[model samples]
Target: MFTGIVQERGEVVALDLAPDGADARVTVRGPLVTQDVQHGESIAVSGVCLTVVASHEDTFTADVMAETLLRTSAKEWAPGRAVNLERSVTPTTRLGGHVVQGHVDGIGTIVARVPHDGYDEFSISVGKDLARYIASKGAVAVDGISLTVIDVNDSPTGAVFTLGIIPETRTATTLGGAAVGSSVNIEVDVMAKYVERLLSFRDVEKA
Candidate 1:
């Protein structure tokens, strides 16, 4: 489990694809997150849970399976690409942010970014299937950084949500450099899904 708190902004050192048509391996330089990381431990890279296959002084290698690449922006990762890094929560860790499972529910597109008062307001497009799980003022993880949803709008095309990014968040995480068309890993609050599932069961019991 992760708290969705970005501990550091890491750079993708390299991404190596296998010749056997298999998964790719990604090497990231994140001294902060790797300070005490061990092999096989989980790390949240841009909100995707990756296990460390190899550990080094200042970097670590993690294999990206085909399914993970297909479901996340990891396929677009290249050398020098900025990525948000977060270590898994420990027993004594503070829950600074909401509970995040490091599972990317779906990819979201950056629709617009409006600068206001040294901050940026981002509008992102999400899949309509995941729209019901999102709510105004709910916690959402974008590129591994936990953020509160400012508002949401549903349309025939898709669901669009707005987020208020502060100056600190803009500079401290990869979201600062994200462009309008960039894809980001998104994870909605798990509690919302649980509530919906329970409601469905209740309805069935009433029948």
Candidate 2:
């Protein structure tokens, strides 16, 4: 489990596709983070739960399968690109952010970014596929960073939600550099997903 609190911004050092055509190696350099990660430690990389295959003081390598790559934004990473990094929560750690699985629910695109000098409010496109889980003032993870949904509305294609970004958020992760039309990996609240699953099961039982 992760708290969604971003620890540091990491630079993509390497990204090589594995031979299986379903897995790839993702290496990142983050030195301020020294938590003694094991070979199988769970690491949240831009909202994706990647198991560590190799780890060191300043770098760690994780294998991401094609399913993970397609489900999240890891495939969009290139050498020198920036990404949000966070270690899994420990017993002694504080719950700074909400429960985040690092599992991308679906992909969304930035529809508009409205700047008000100090901060910006961004509206993005969320479709029916992802809209059911979204609630006003609820938590949403975009590119691995936790954010609150400001508003929501339905469209012909899907639902559209607006998110308010503070200056700190704009400077912390890739969201700061995101532009309109940019694809963002989204992970909705875990509780919302579970509730939906329960509802589906109930429907099946009734049928």
Candidate 3:
């Protein structure tokens, strides 16, 4: 588990894709997260929970399965791409952000960006299926950085949400350089999903 607090911005050092396109191996250089990381430990890389398969110096390697590739922006990752990195939280860790499972629900695209004096507001579009899990003032993890949804708008086909990005977030995470067309991994509040599941049983009982 994680608290959606980004520890560092890491860079992909190498990416080796299998010939069959079934899976791929990636090596990321994250000095802070790799300092005490061990094999088999979990690390949230761009909101995807990946296990450390190997570690060397300041770099650690993890395997990306086909399912993760299809569900996240990992397929677009290449050498030199910057990514948000966060180490799994311990029992004593503070929940600075919110409960983040590192399980990306889907990929969202930045549709617009508005600059402010001390901050910026970005509008991202996601499929309605995923948008149903998001709400205004609620928490969402974008590329492993927890952000509060400023607003939400629904369209016929999809939905868009606005997020206020302070200067600290811009400099501390990869969102600093994200362009309008860039893609990001999004993880909605896990509690919302659990509540929906529990409500489904209530509906069944009503029938």
What TM-score would you give candidate 1 relative to the actual structure?
A: 0.94
Record all residue pairs in model 2 with backbone atoms less than 3 Å apart, i.e. clashing.
22-66
Of the candidates shown, which would achieve the greatest lDDT relative to the real structure? Answer: 3
What's the TM-score of each model vs. the native? 0.94, 0.94, 0.98
Model 1 agreement with the true structure over 34-71: per-residue lDDT tens digits: 99889999999999999999989999999999888888
Question: Compared with the true structure, what per-residue lDDT tens digits does model 3 show for residues 5-38?
Answer: 9999999998899999889999999999999899
lDDT of 3: 0.96
Least accurate stretch of 10 residues (summed lDDT) in model 3?
150-159
lDDT of candidates 1 onward, in order? 0.92, 0.87, 0.96
State the lDDT of candidate 2 residue by residue for 80-150, as single tens digits: 98888888888999988888888899999999999987789999897889998889999999888888899
Query: Clashing residue pairs, candidate 1?
Result: none
TM-score of 3: 0.98
Clash totals in order = 0, 1, 0
How far residue 59's Cα lies from its native spot in candidate 2, in Å, is 1.0
For all predictions, the C-alpha RMSD in Å is 1.4, 1.5, 0.8
